[model samples]
Target chain A: MSIFETIRFALRGLVANKLRSGLTVLGILIGVGAVILLVAVGNGSAKVIEESIESLGTNTLTISSGGFGRQSSTSTSSTSLTVELATALADQSAAPHVKTVSPVVTSSSLAATYEDTDVTVGSFIGTHPDYATASNFSIKSGAMFTTDDVNDHSKVVVLGSTVAEGLFGTVDPLGQQINVSGKLFTVIGVLAEKGSSGLSDPNDLAIAPLSAVQESLTGYGSLSQILVQAVSADDIDTAQAEVTSILNEKLGVTSTSSSTPYRIMNQAELLETRTSNAKTFTTLLGAVAAISLLVGGIGITNIMMVTVTERTREIGIRKALGAPKRTVLNQFLVEATVLSVIGGLLGVAGAVIGSQFTIMGTKPVIVPSSVLLALGVSVGIGLFFGSYPASRAASLRPIEALRYE
Target chain B: MSAHRANRPVLDVRNAKKIYGSGEATVVALAGVSLTVHRGEYVAIMGSSGSGKSTLMNILGCLDIPTTGRYLLDGVDVSKLNDRQLALVRNRRIGFVFQSFNLIPRTTALANVELPMAYAGVRSAERKRRAHAALDLVGLADRADHEPNQLSGGQQQRVAVARALVTAPALVLADEPTGNLDTQSTADVLAVLDSLNQSGRTIVLITHEDDVAMHAKRVIRLVDGKIVSDQRNGHLAASRSAMLRDAYSTAVYR
Candidate 1:
């Protein structure tokens, strides 16, 4: 028979066993859905990481004490970074590519209160005035602490937007006093809100003059980490090299080896590492999901085999009616392909709906290419897995089949 | 037994032999059987179970090849053709009516009638027209849209006959076409076959019932892989020719 007639016959056969056909389609539906959802999650995480990197500003770098690389005894001794080193790095002659520098010490779980409204700041940061410009922070209301305030160890603090809202609500907190670890400090300024970025949200922390936090909270002379900003995006590498040498000189280290005393994280490298990691995770998840697709293909084969056996008499009748073996084969194969195509379309719909649900704590991103590819694979699965049963149907002897009852 | 006829026979078999298996398990289904059937002949092959009638019917239908034979079907050496060529021969030259009606389930009567021509690559429009005409010939024109399950036993068999005739094949091979029908349905099917034969269609029906075989113009009885008797029904043959004469006169007057 012609291909069109054969396909019509196959469709009729599938309709006769609706429940079985629907169940078979369900297998492929789930397989494609899993594949699309996992791949989407991978793409979504990569996109989220890229956006976070943009928010961090492309020319900024963070230099923290304790080297990230292999640390031996020689490298370990130079890990002690003091606030004095930060002062020397601020000099233009020592690091010409550096635009600004800020020494920072961060402590977690410091409760601040104004009257009965108590707020636990996620992070309490102590840094100099340059910290505002270096870390992309802006003054929302009151003025920032001055250099004299830093040197005199003034008890003055600047609340991040979220912290300010939590501490004083609509009331002006510029001259109001709040207790930080039982020590009263005057609120001098409120930094503008910076949402979650590649690094933690800057608006969730409270900032103060370096000297005040050093004596009142941490009671340490050593600085936690330093925030550095380059003169321009193109000068970030040069600024990093200049800062490394300056830090080495200030610590009296003559040799620079693989085990540096401090680690420098540039904005560009951070973005690249995170995006590549997300891609790897996506590929791994996609591979696992593909295994279920393979199983789904096997389900098609199993169902096709059963259909061929059940329709032996019908095959015999067709053969007796002068149908060629290839016609019989095409009928069964077309039925399987139809099943897979229907399942694939349903899977695309399911994946789209599934993507809205959070996976790995992030919403999935369904890639168009992945949807098309998954659909193609499902059709291919039908053809590949449907072959044996179709051939078996084609090879049935007319006389035996007619007599099969 | 083969008979020498004035005209070329539609089916001619010489010493046809068919064996089921090899060596110790061998069962010779048809042993040195010979037969000849001319065009427009309504013949019945009758025998009990294990009498090799099915084997003979299978050979005539081109569904199986003989172990050793010279079988010429409409001037072609059917025994020498390959599986695909044999299928083509069946499609173009032979039509089959099964005992179970064997109409594809869930299909309209018209589609079942059109099936053989479809396999023969007949275009859709012509296939539909010819299928409708065949159903009309079998007196099932009104039931063309009905599925086999929705039709009575006699209507289903009539649809089968229409399917067999749609191809205008060289031979109509019916194996127990009315076995599953009631007495009234059997009479209805036999009347359709008789009318088809009267219109010059060639038919070979396989059955063991004497009453069913009595409807045919000739009867061949098989026993132990051999033809035990070949008899012509003088009364039926005479009446068929007289009816043909009457049809010819009516056509002339029209």
Candidate 2:
């Protein structure tokens, strides 16, 4: 028979029993839809992390205590990072990509007031002149604190755009005095609006000179940590290797069992880890969804087998009329493949709608490539499941089938 | 079994055997049966229920392979031909009609005739043309668009006959083709089959009614899978043939 007639015959058979065909297709749709939705959500979260890493301070290398991880120390257990070490690293001329660096003396309890409404911000950083340059902060108003500001204990501060707005709305608060825990400090500069960058919240920060923050309210001479910036993004690898060696030596640490002294997270490592984590998550969810698709194929197999039994006389009639086994096999296979193709297309449509429904307003949204791959997998499912029942139908003896009541 | 040599019978079978089930529990459906059908001959095989007449029909139709025996179809050993080859032979050399007027339900008369050729892989245009010619031969040309359920019993049988004739096969196998029709319908279907046979087509019919078998030129009575009597109708079909020719000529003249 002509190819068109074969399809026409198969389509007629499906149309003859509409509800059965719909139910079969329904199984496939849910399988494909689940795969698409599960994979999209997992990959989307990973993309958010990547976006945070990319928009962080440009050319900056972040170093923290490694191996020991978080909760290694509240005070004096692990290797202590000092401002003197940060100063030593900054004074290097041999490292060409080495740029301005800063040592941070961060603490939680820092108070500030402009008019009267002063909310205690959670974060505070005490650093040098290079702190502003290395952190990618663009001053919106007055100048950054000079190296002399740290040396002379000048109580000067620069507020992030959000913190500036919260304390002194629309009013130009530059050249004004802000009380920091009962001590007056001049707001020399206000940062321009560059929203949240990586782990740092744009709001809730108050920058102060390293010497004044240590001597006045804090009353401690120790540094919490240090920050470094490279001249360019490409120099991150070279800069990270040099900075690691310096911090390990400076922190007074010998690599021991309980601690590796300090930790480090550079721009390159951050991006690399995020991508690998996303791949793992996407694969895990995709596999779960694929199982559902396989279940759908089994559903088709179940239905085709029933159809064979129900149409026993029809098979008898065709066989007696000289229909070869291959012909009978093709007929059933066509029916299954047609059902799967329809289901797969419907699944793609459902996934697209789901992406819009779930993602809300997050940027750098996940792009689903597996939805298409899943559809192709469904076609293979049809061939896989359809084969057994078709072979069974073909194997039927014409005389015995005809004799069936 | 009778001897069949070169330039001999079109179909020859010797000691054919067909057993249902296996070993100690087997029931023999056809036991050492033998028969022959020549080209351009009309033969009727008759038997009651459990007499294995239907089983013989199935084997002759190539729908079932015989368990043991040498059955030669036009001098080729059918016992040796595989399932696929037997299917090819059935498509090219044999056509079938059933007592139930086994035209596919809801199909038009033309499509019913076209169905056999379709399986034979004939091109669509040729299949359509040949089906139309077969319908014309059965006097169902004007009822070409009539579905089996829409037509009268006689017309439906004529359509079945048309289906059997469309492929121009060497043999037309009718298993009690007129069993379900009334006397008038039976006469109509018999007249159609008679005309086909007169046109040099070989036909084998299976029926339990002696009245039905009277239309054939030869009769083989089967009992319990064994042939009890095999005889020629002798001068009965010759007289009937002349009578049918006169009747058709008068109808055409009118």
Candidate 3:
């Protein structure tokens, strides 16, 4: 038979029983929908992690002193880091991978006024201007501080982009001086905006020089930690080992780590671990949804069986009129495929509606592969599920079927 | 003894046997039946229940393969033909109308008639034209769109008859085709069958009622799987009940 003819007959048979076909395809829709959606979420998270890791200087290695534990994110509390160590690292002859080593010390004293808005925030850092380059900061309006400003130990600070907007408003705050506990720091340049990373909001603080902060902001005896960067991103592992070895030899500390208590986390390794976990979770969720697809196939089979029983006499009539078993099987099989294919299309429709728009506007995300895969699988399901029923219809004894009342 | 027999009969059966099961559980459906039917002959096979007349009709219809026999249809031995071949033979040479009007429910009269043509691979346009013609022959062209549920008993039987004759097969094997019909409907359906028979089409009708058997030119009656009465219906009886059907429809329509 021609394709059109097969489709026509199959469509007629499907239309004859609506509820049965509808319920059957519902399973497949849920299965395919779940799989596509979960994979999308997994892909989305992968993108986020990749970007975050790349933002942490893909071509640079960072070394910190004092905050070694995994829980000690950037909170520099230990007194082990000092400006002397930062100077020695910067002066190292063998540290060819070293780009710049800037000691970091933070002090939190609130209450800053610009115009009329006075917000008492926390977490302020004091470091060299090269910290901007190492941390991937992008300036919206002004430049970062010059090295001369760092050398002079001038009481100069730059505001994070968010702080610049939040405090300075439209007025140029570059030339203005902000008072911190009777000490005034000149605003040299406005640091650019760096949006939130996994750890911290880059635009939520003010940055100042380490020497200036020690003299004027914190008044602590020594710096809290040193932020060291390597020149090339690929050499991070080697650079990391060198930094740790130098810290141990310089700090006069004995080797006391079971698994390197001074934890050195490369962003790449963390990203890899996260990606694998996401894949596993996505597949697990997708498998749960696949059960619904299986349910749909079974539904089709059951309904087709019922149809065979109901049309027993018709089968007999056709057989007596010269229809072969193969022809009969083909007819029923065609009908089954038609029902499944329509249901699969409905599933695609359902996924689009269910995922992106109805399921909080995350649309069913038409990955061309999913559409083709779902349709292919459903067609296969129809053949497998419809076989027994179609065969049963074909195998009906003509004599008995004709005798059926 | 017959003109067609001088050549070759359209149907020739010799020592045909059909047993229900094997070994000690076997029940013979047909026991060594032999018969010959020429073309253009109206034959009626009649019997009480379990007399093997029904079995004979099934065999004649090519609905079952005999366990043992030499059954020839149109000079070709049918006992050796495959199931697929038998089905083709049935469609090309034999049309069938059942007692219960085995028209597919929820289908219109036109579609019911066109169904067999579809299985025969007749294209759409020709199928529609021929199906309409069959419906017109049964005087149900106006009711083509109506489903079996909407049609009266006689109309439904007429639709079945239209289906049977739509392909213009060589023979029509109606197994008690009018058994469930009212007298009027039976007359209408039987008259259509009779006219078609008179047009040189072979027809084999199975019936227990003598009133129906009298409509045919020949009768073969079986009792206990054996032929007990084989006679020409030339002087046996007339179909009084079927005649009453024609009278009732004439009164109703005219």
lDDT (tens digit, per residue) of candidate 2 on A211-247: 8888876766556767788878888878877776676
Top DockQ model: 1
- The DockQ of predicted model 2 stands at 0.46
Clashing pairs in 2: A64-A263, A65-A262, A65-A263, A66-A262, A66-A263
Residue lDDT tens for model 1, B1-254: 12232145788999999998899999989988899987777899999999998989898999888999889997789988877888898898898988999999888999899888888999999999999999999998999999989999999999999999888887899999989999999999999999888777778999989999998988999999999899998576664564455344324422
lDDT of 3 by residue, A61-84 (tens): 444444345224534333356777
DockQ per model, Cα: 0.67, 0.46, 0.49
Question: Root-mean-square deviation of each candidate, in angstroms?
Answer: 4.8, 5.6, 7.0
lDDT of 2 at A336: 85
Q: In candidate 1, which residue ranges exceed 4 Å CA deviation?
A: A42-59, A68-100, A107-111, A116-122, A128-156, A169-175, A181-185, A188-203, A209-222, A230-242, A245-258, A267-284, B1-7, B234-254
lDDT of 2 at B8: 57
The alpha-carbon deviation from the true structure for residue B151 of candidate 2, after best TM-score superposition, in angstroms, is: 6.0
Q: Which residue pairs collide, candidate 3?
A: A59-A233, A139-A192, A321-B91, A322-B87, A356-A361, A356-A362, A356-A363, A356-A364
Clashing pairs in 1: none
Task: After the best TM-score superposition of candidate 2, give how far the Cα of residue B240 lies from its true spot, in angstroms.
Answer: 14
Model 3: reference contacts kept, as a fraction: 0.68
Q: What is the TM-score of each candidate against the true structure?
A: 0.86, 0.83, 0.81
